[model samples]
Every structure is written in C-alpha cells, then in structure tokens.
Target: MPAKDKMDKTKMVTCTAPVNIAVIKYWGKRNEELILPINSSLSVTLHQDQLKTTTTVAVSRSFQDDRIWLNGKEEDIAHPRLQSCLREIRRLARKRRNDGAAGLDSTGLSHKVHICSVNNFPTAAGLASSAAGFACLVYTLAQVFGVEGELSGIARQGSGSACRSMYGGFVQWIMGNTDDGKDSLAQQVEPETHWPELQILVLVASAERKPVGSTSGMQTSVQTSCLLKHRAESVVPGRMVEMIEAVRKKDFPAFAELTMKDSNQFHATCLDTYPPIFYLNRVSQQVINLVHRYNRHYGETRVAYTFDAGPNAVIFTLRQHVSEFVHVVQHFFPPETNGGDFIKGLPVNHTALSEELKQGIGLEPMPKGVSYIISTKVGPGPCVVEDPSQHLLASDGLPKECV
Candidate 1:
C-alpha cells in the first residue's frame, strides 16, 4: 500500500448507546474485577433520542498509540477498565482470525486506535452515563474490528450496568455463579416495542457529578452494608422475578410498585453502609413524596420514582399520565425557566393542574428543585451510525469537536 493510502486506511465505526434505569437494582459486586454483580438486576433502557452516548473508534497504521477523548477532554487511555475492554476486544479479533473467520483484518489488529466519546446527558450524575459510555465504547470498537455477538459481557467488564445498556427495553443482568464470569451477562427481557404505553421522565435534580461514584459506593456497600448483602442475597432474587413478569405482562401497577420499593431499598442499603453514602438530596426526597402522593390521590400506582447513585429521579408512568405527572412535577418543583425550557426530548402536552389534585398532595413548591425533565420512552439498544458526519472522531484520528 502507498504511504498516503496507508495513512488513509483508518477503519472507523461510530455507534450510540442508551442509558438504562434499573428497576431491580444491582448494588454490589461479587467479583469487582470482572464486574459480576452479587444479584440479578433488571432495567429499562431509555431511548437514545433523549439520553445516549455517541462513540467513534478509529484504527490506523499511522497512529502511534491507543488514545482517547471523552466529551472533548483527553482522558487517560491507560485506565484499567478501558484497557480491559481494549484487551478483550483485541483478543476476540485475534481469536476470530485464528479461527479463519472471513474478512478478518490481520494487519489492522496491530494498529493503534483513537477513540472519542460524548454523552448527551450528564456523566456521574446517576443517570447511568458510564453504562451508555462504556457500552458505546465496546460496541463501536467491536464494529471497527469486525467482531460481533454477545458483546455485553465485554461491556460489563467496563461497567456492571453497561451490559444492561447493550440491549433495549427491559433487560436483566444475570449474576452467573461461574468464577470466570462467562455466564454473567445481560439478556433482553423484552424488545423496545414491547411496552409502548409506558413512558419515562427523568427529573434532573442536578446535572452536577454525584458526591460518590457508583464503583466506590458499591465497594463500600459490599464491604460494610449487611443490608446490601441481604438485599442482594434475598430481596433482589424475588424482585427480579416479579419485575421480569411485570415487564412481560405490561402490568404498570405491579411494575411501578416494584420499581419504587426496590429503589427505596437500594438507598436504604446506601444508608446502611459504614460511612453512609448520601446519593439522594432533598429534591430527590421531594420527588419520592410527590410520586407517592400522586399515586395515593388516584388510589393506584399511576407513577413511580427511582433514583440511582444520584439525586436525579427517573419516573415511570403510562403515556396518558405523562402530561399530568409532568405538570405535577412543575407545580411542586417550579422551574426557573419557562415550561418549554424545563422539559427536553419528546414534547409534553400542556395539562392544567386541578385545585383538587394540588390540595390532595399539598406540598410546598421548591423553586428549581429539578433542573429539567427528559421525556423519553423505551428504545432500542446500541446502534451503528452509518452516517460519516455523526462520527465523533475526524478522519485524522482526532476529536472533531476539539479540532
């Protein structure tokens, strides 16, 4: 190959992965290195249209070493989790080549790679940014290397919940008993189209990074929180079964009840930790109260709130209730900006808050408790973006945004 051709021979792929909200949460890891959860967990993958991470990976002979840029800032490519993902993907590619898999690029395997990833949502704010980020990273790299099939296990090595983001709609991360962690993988419980009536509203209490990261939080919980151990060993198994059944049956009430209970329990375990990690702020507590009051006034579970390792509340409700629930949120947590600015993603119709409804809940308005709300629904898993313009990295193996 000519020098110019060799320089131009960049094998690149770009992909987007969705953030996921766990209903039956995964709190602790049995094997920290492998990211094997202590218990099974189920989650709903939010639509990429609302929340996603886009990643581009390019491999070329001209590149000197593995490099990475995240959200326009250069990050340490030598990070262990990153190296784990990179090593695994290369191992798979080499294995394929050894097995005489068609279209295997023998030379490209030795080339350096440039990676650029950015999230539409806030990172480390408990919105599962790492889930989408690492999922996109592993996925785009796999596509670039001509590798495919069951990449969730590899994504898990990067972030435990990342495996769940590898699939759309309802997903369950099975905590396999194997020491090698081969059986511990994500499996889709249902496709994106399975629950069209169900809608999700991410109440962004704060976009700022959480006080404690999930990795560190989970580590502490595993070591100190006996509640975490019991929940993982006892509660999660039963809830996982119920959650899966609720998702399959499209039982909103059952699903909502389980979601709220599991979320509450997850946080309780956080409190039970030796040092006690506080992920939820006053805003999160208010959201939780509002959700229950809203459901109570209706004498049923119309809405449910779940928080991860941050103050942001992820609410699940039916499409019909979205307008009213959003309005309710607005009434309680009055935004600093206009309604249009307060809500992002899918448009929500204006719904008048009735005096009866307001009086029933009777909560004092907290101005700007939530920054904004992201209205989205169940959506597909990681997807390849064929459009060259969508690539985060330029043809020269640098972040387009930075350039």
Candidate 2:
C-alpha cells in the first residue's frame, strides 16, 4: 500500500563536465557581473576520468523549496552565479513552451529544482572547479526542464572560464566586442582525436583555497595593473592566432612556448596590481626552473609548465616524454614515503633515471613539495549519465544516501 500510494512524480537528469586549464589565461573582466573577459583565452580540456564535476538536477512538485547540495552539504541556491544558471534555464524552457516545441513538460517547468554537484577533485584546489561545476549545473538543469542549445553563453554568466568547459579538446573563448556578449562564446579549435599523444600532468603543490579569488584579484589587476591592459590590447590578439595554428599543426614546441609565456604574463599582471598579488611560491619557482633545465638538457622543448591562480603546476608534454619527465619530477619532489595514490589517472610506466640525465640538469631534491600527480589526456565535453543509479539526488528530491 505504501509503494502504491507514493509513486514518485520527480523528474531528474545527471551529467559530468571536465575542468579546463587555460593555456592562454583569462584574468581580467571587462564587465564584472556578466563575466566578459578582457582578453580571449585558449585551453585543453582534460579527461573527465581524472578530474571533473558530476551534477544531478531533480524537479518535483513535492519539494518544499529550490535547494542545492555541494559535496554532500547544503548550500544557498541564491548565490548569484547559481541563480543566473537557474534563471536562464527556466527562461529558455518558457520560450520553448510558448513556441509550442514538442515534448514540452509544462508541469515540470512549474516545479522547483534541487541540484547536487560533486567534484572528483577537491573544490578549492585552484584547479578550475567552478568552470566544470557551473557547466554541469546548466547542462543537467536544461535536460530536466526540456530546454537546450547554446548554453555556453548562459554558463559564461556563471563563471568566465566555465564557457570553455562546455566543449572539449582544444577550445578558445573569443572575447566579443558586443555589449550584450552574444559573440563572446567558446568554439572548439580541434576535437579530442586531433592529437592522440598529448598528455597533461597536474603536479599538486597544495590542496588549499587561494588567498585571493580570481574575481576580486582580477578586478584589482584591471583597475591597477597597466601590464594587464597592454597584454589584453596589444599582446593576446596575435598570440591567439599563433596558438590556434600551433594546435592545428600539433606543434608541441610552439604550443609549449606560447602556453608557458601566456601563463607567466597572466601572473605578471597579478604582481603588477596595486596591492600586489602573489600566486606562485618557492615550490612553483622550483618547478619552473626544473622544466627549463629539463628542456635544455634534451636540447629541445619536451615539457612545458603552466600555473593557474594557485601554486600547483599543470605540465603539458607528449607521450614520448611522459615517463622520463615524470621521473624527473619524482626524483626532485619525492612523494610521501608513507604511500598514497601518487599518480591518479593513467599509469606512469616505471623508467630508470640515468645519472647522466640527472647530473646534466642538476637540481636539489625538494622532498614532499608536490603531493602527487594526475596523468591525463585530452578528452570529450560534458556527458549524460543515462543510468538511474548515477543520480546524486533521490526520487524524494533529497541527496541520495549521501554520507
């Protein structure tokens, strides 16, 4: 009788989105609230298996109010970015209904939604969690409300970097000149299959929240840093063209050079800010020095390093260079002796480090500086989880057995 009486009326959809590391960083915002960037940026979307956000959205008439749970904890649904994503999805659904699109769920449209999002990686680790987070939220919500198409523009309103995570492979976010930001959207320069051997490694320096968030930090840079203005106007345009060509040709050397330089300049602008922001520490500088020495030792650019808003190093290298370069890293920043998942994703084949190679690039070992590394490669965009059991929320519209 209980089962018969309580047939669930909830509708739900679940999806996952990968985090994007900006090779050409997006630092300053031209328009703050809309998240319009001062300069366009390019990035490689890493595989979801290693790092991503999984979100589930549920709509039910029985729910008391619209709510959300982030990593098994309740959070305010009215946070501006979250609110923007929720509002836009509903608006699109309303338009589809007014236009009489087939399979319209008018009843579900009126129901409140409960959103649950969890990341495969740590939330405040400065690994672009918000980008994947918002992208997944917008995507799953669209599926629940029966509205879809061109959601990146809406995702951009949630987080600037988020637009890039809407697609996979090599992506570029074109900073549009229009006031309404219609043209400012993400475009895939190449699909994941374009380059099979390209690999990404995340050298975790620390798993902690940044002292300053990107929004406020960049705002200070925009107002105070002249380097940022010059970089936006005179530098990024030409670099965008060169970066796109490098990806198209699979020119690792060219791509590596550009990626490293852009990352440096982005951090440079941060230092030039009035109060002066510092994202890199002693560990970061050591990693940068090691990368240069390694390339010099090989007489070519075999590896490149980029840093986001935190101290962690995101290294880009080809398959041929992976084992040796990883060997270099492990030798310099030895993992904990107690044991952990030192490498998270693809297995790193054990390779011997020759004395000739080690002494050639001479650097003092900095034990335990890096927590671990995540070995991954270019991967596809956001995806749907068709299985019912994957849902993060239950038919009762609460977190589904979350511990």
Candidate 3:
C-alpha cells in the first residue's frame, strides 16, 4: 500500500504564540549554533490577543517538497534555523514511532510539510517577533507530528529568546552549563494570574527595522565588550534570583527597580562593544527620562521602561496607574492629532493630566515621537487553535492567503 493509503489525506495543526519582553535581558551567546545564552534571563509573556504569531502546518503525501510562507509571502525553506527545527521534530517523531508510541501518526512522519505564519505586530523592530515566530513554528509542527514533551530546547535553536516563549506568564530562561546545550531551557516563575494588576504598554518609537540586529550586535558585544563579559559572569546571576523573588512576592517596586537597572546595564554593555552598537534613539532616551521623572514626582517607582535591540519602549506599570501614566506619555510625546487611536489593545480610561504633574515631568514635548502604544497584560504561552477556519493553509496544503 502507498503511504497515502496508510494516512489521512492531510494532517494539519494551527497554533498561536505570544511575544515575551525580557526584564533581565539575554544578550551574548556561549555557543552560537545552539543559541545558548551567557546568562539566565527572565521575561513576561504578553497577551496573545494584543500581540501574537499565528502559524499553520500541514503534512500530506501529495506534496512534492517542504514549503513555507511568512506573512503571505513565500520564504526560503532551506534556511538553516528552519532546517534545525524541521530535522529535530522529524527525528523525534521517528523515534516515538519506533518505540511504538500510541497516537503516533506513523505515515505522516515521512510526508512533506507546508507552513504559513504571520505576526499581528511589526517584525524585527525589537518587539521580540523572532521569539514568538520560532516558538509558534516548533509548537505547530509538534502538534501535527504528535510529538510532545519538553520542546523549549528545540525552540532555542531557532532563536535564543524563543525558548522563554514556550511558557506562560513570567518565565526564566536558565543558561545551563553544558557543551551540547541539553539543559538550557525555560521555566515559568509565575502563571498569568499571578499578578493581575500588572500592565504592559509598548511605545512604538519606530516600526521600521533596527539598524543593528540582535544577533550581529550580540556577536560583536561578546568579542569586544569587557563590560559584557563582566555582566554575564558577575551581574546577571544575582539579579535572576532577585527577579524571581520579586515576582513571587508581587513586590512592584523591587520588580520595577530591577527591571530598569537591568535594561540600563544591557544598553551600557551594547555601548561598550567595539564600534558601539546604538539601538536606542533620541525618542527612546526621552521615554527613559520621562519614566524616571514621573517616578521621582511620586516619590516612588510607579513605572519602569525596558528596551530590547530596538528603539521601542516597553513600559511595566500597575493597573491603577496605567491611565494616568498613559496620559503623561501623551503629554510628553504627543501623537499626531490625525493619528487614529494613539493607544491600541486593551482599553485605557481617559485621565486628565494635572498641571503639577506636567510641571513635575517638565520635559519638552516631542510631537509624534512615539508611533503609538499597545496596551496589554501578562498572558499564556503557545496555544492550539481548535477552529479549522482559523488555519492559515487550506485543504490543498497551500497558504489560504496566497492567490
């Protein structure tokens, strides 16, 4: 009998993964191939409703070869990282089949796959798009192949931060000490409900691609920056412990302070790199200043800001303070009046800015400095979509969006 006779006409799976913002950033790599980090890092997984990547993977014997489309455009399927994920998932499926695992789709193991993925937010603009993308790809592929258990290590091979995206709520990526990278994986510190009042606002300074990609920038930082070396060895280990504690205790001030400090140090290491990689722009600096000034005015840390490999500012604050803080952001970095809804995602109640608050901030208003804000909260990890209508690929094993 042909392989088609032993298998269903098509086996497909769809999944969505959320973007994660590292509070204790992951910078350099110990091993480039495995994408192992120099130090352990922690991040908050943003709600999928506000930001996410949806991916569909279909397997069929009729397909001649493997193919992929990203955001409605076909991409090179031979890309090395993509190959790593594909190879590993198939290898796992074969192993399980040989072991006589129940519910294994034996015939589909040899079939070709077609993958279609798209992000709700901007890609490569330092919004952790790769983290969500790779996580979703690995997850959707596993679902189709009936492979289960510990897949974060496989996701890490695609993108360093991708490992952390495997879990929900507050997660930590432990930089394991191993040559083969068998131990470097992500674990959740807390669930999405751990801190219900916690809120995240993404200030999109620019949606365009960053001047320096995180991969190249990190390679350079490892080569030249002594500060980066010092940070990896001495700094991050202690902060990881403290961050976990703060999360567990629900201590907002401690969490905010550690977050801001880590972000500052991460950027400092970038500057210490030879030829100095610059990710933050003038608008980013203004955001930083505004955050500190706003906190100082209240005599406490009400909000904190962190920037990853790009100019976008991700702010962490409490639900009680979100409305006012947003108003403050509007006052300092006025959006274009013609711009549709300056705030996106979760709704924010309108709060009038006080004259005293404005004077306390006392910064020159930079009109349209920030493109817009995405208001979201901590949420779950990769999830399967039960509805067949949501699949990105149709029954013929092709992207639905492709004409």
Q: What is the C-alpha lDDT of each candidate?
A: 0.93, 0.91, 0.94
> Order the candidates by TM-score, highest first — what do you get?
1, 3, 2
TM-score for each model: 0.98, 0.97, 0.98
Q: How many residue pairs clash in each candidate?
A: 0, 0, 0
Residue lDDT tens for model 1, 1-403: 8977965588888999999999999989889899998999999999999899999999999899999999889999999999999999999999999999987777789889999999998888889999999999999999888887889999999999999999998999999999999999999999999999999999999989888889999999999998998898888888888888999999999999999999999999999998999999999999988988988899999999999999999999999999999999999999998887999999999999999999999899999899999999999999999999988888889998667
Worst 10 residues of 1 by lDDT: 3-12
TM-score of model 1 relative to the true fold?
A: 0.98
Ten contiguous residues with the weakest lDDT in model 2: 1-10
Best by lDDT: 3
For model 2 the local lDDT of residue 210 reads 86
Stretches off by above 4 angstroms in model 1 are: 1-8
Off by over 4 Å in 2: 1-8, 338-340
